[model samples]
Target: MPEVLIEAVQPGSPDTGAVAHYGDPVREQRTLEGAAGLVDRSHRGIIAIPGEDRLSWLHSLTTQHLTDLRPGEGSELLVLSPHGHVEHHAVLTDDGTTTWLDTEPGTAPALLDFLNRMRFLMRVEPADVTADWALLSLVGPEARIPGIELDPPKVAPVPGAKFASADVAPRPTTVYSTAPLPGGGWARRMAYGYDLLVPRSRVAAVADELAVPWAGIWAFEALRVAARRPRYRLETDHRTIPAEVGWTADAVHLDKGCYRGQETIARVHNLGRPPRRLVLLHLDGVSTDELPAPGTAVSTADGRDVGFVGTAVRHHELGMIALAIVKRNVGDDEQLRVGVSAAAIDIP
Candidate 1:
């Protein structure tokens, strides 16, 4: 498990869990409510691909349309095993000679090691930039910061909002536009390119000046669940494939040329159905006093193992809701029991 580092933003304020380096709960809530806030995601992996063959080298390894990615364009992609298991899902962006890969924190080292093993005398070089660059997430309504634009025009924008990036004080910055949610909620992230390290003493001052919110892992987990995003460790594992997690819409590119797991992805897309499907579960008659453990069996009224719960939360408005991976043939409106505790969950 990744250890969350807690940093205090204000004197006597609650210690915040910085998933990367700084966590702010107030900022996290603002992020969910569409308020402009910043989050430090620097702890997440940031890999730089430099040198002449950077683009070509990366294109050959990941499953996305990277060959034609423009200087300021970003796309999500997956690194897959030859047998079709998902190795890692990454956000790829290029800034001239170097391409930046933003991935989960703990997963970066292993990925870098794998890429290094496959270097094979290529001109490309891969290096970890987490320590050098600070990742700031600007999200919510009215979150635009001066000079950024969203990429796809069709995606809805929050009122008085646009996405942009800026240089980390005293450093160069690269900004790329991205899609915002419908009805005025969106997220924009900027990576401050630093030539020299910023002192840790001024970290909180920088964060405070930027208005970045402190978010804990719990708050982030809730936001991801609300967005219906599948996480790496909780909802996925070695046996999981990109298609099984419904990541094709964002991660995999079907028309792209041969890459690891391309055959399996194509075959599954064209000829086979996903054995299990992801679903939202709303628990009924449960209070703060009683909560079902994750991985507890979910069975049909007739007692068949339909699925198991993955994550659950107590919503301010919706009571308790969960995410579950269940057998595909299960009816959308079916009522199922979680564990032998008699707790019923309605498929939504």
Candidate 2:
């Protein structure tokens, strides 16, 4: 696992005595598709935004159209700088009283400060709840997964997922917000999972409640890459425009009232192409044990630096795979290389 993935799942034994992959990545992926697989994603920063104005206030600032989000609805939102660079990508869920934000690690403090500064007497109160709330993810068949369905992420190409809708009573010890994820068929890339926003005190108990074999970051990273989902740190940064990464649909509501960086998104999406495009690299026969590092240069056959690789993984099914950003002008069939190994680019 790369450092980013290692840190995400490294809480290892301390969180719930969870084993990395239950001894087999293939079995874990199989169970994830056929039975159940649990992943501890609690390393993500958790922030609680509470108040009457929370939804409306957040709506005005982010790229998502959140003003009308009812309780139990989840949306992905991005906060952009004045110059329209991607500043924050948030996985947000609301339950009427409080809206929970799951962000990249070490990002909550700064994001909290930024949100607070924007709240000048509004009824919104944002609090860093990482110490109090932890995120646990459960995925598999609807019958095998413990809780009600999690919603399929909008704009996310966890594509063509048909989620189970039969309502079930919330768990006794832990309550899960509806995610409405699809069931079965990993090849569909339909995400079927639940993010248990359990109290930090109950993370262990919730892990037990799900009662599935623990999956390491390695297995989950392949799923995210195959689904074409982009993480905040690995796939984006201060220089990213949401549209450049094809996030306008899942993360941005182009018709929503103006907010920070809307202009850049609209301009690129309507009139111009994003300077770079997101690509999935199929590494040519690189050993799984020797994955390339992030920021490793990606080049054309002639060694022209078109872009750099982002998240590189040796996927269980896809072999050595990676997510990258490259110049839009790069041909679809253009063969590229990272380090000594050759790679093929599939731009999304």
Best by lDDT: 2
Predicted structure with the largest TM-score when compared to the true one: 2
Worst 10 residues of 1 by lDDT: 165-174
lDDT of 1 by residue, 1-348 (tens): 233454432221122325522334434554545655444555567778888887777778887656666554565678899998888877766656667777776678888998998899899889987666544454445555443355431111111112122211111112244433222222234221111112334456555554545544445455556556776655665767876677765666665568999988777776557677677677774434355656777899889898777776555455566777788788876768776444443433
Flag regions of model 2 displaced more than 4 Å.
1-22, 142-190, 286-289
- C-alpha positional error of residue 240 in candidate 2 after TM-score superposition, expressed in Å: 1.0
Q: Against the unseen true structure, what C-alpha lDDT does each candidate score?
A: 0.59, 0.69
Q: Candidate 1: RMSD over Cα atoms?
A: 9.9
TM-score of each: 0.74, 0.82
lDDT of 2: 0.69
**What does candidate 1 score on TM?**
0.74
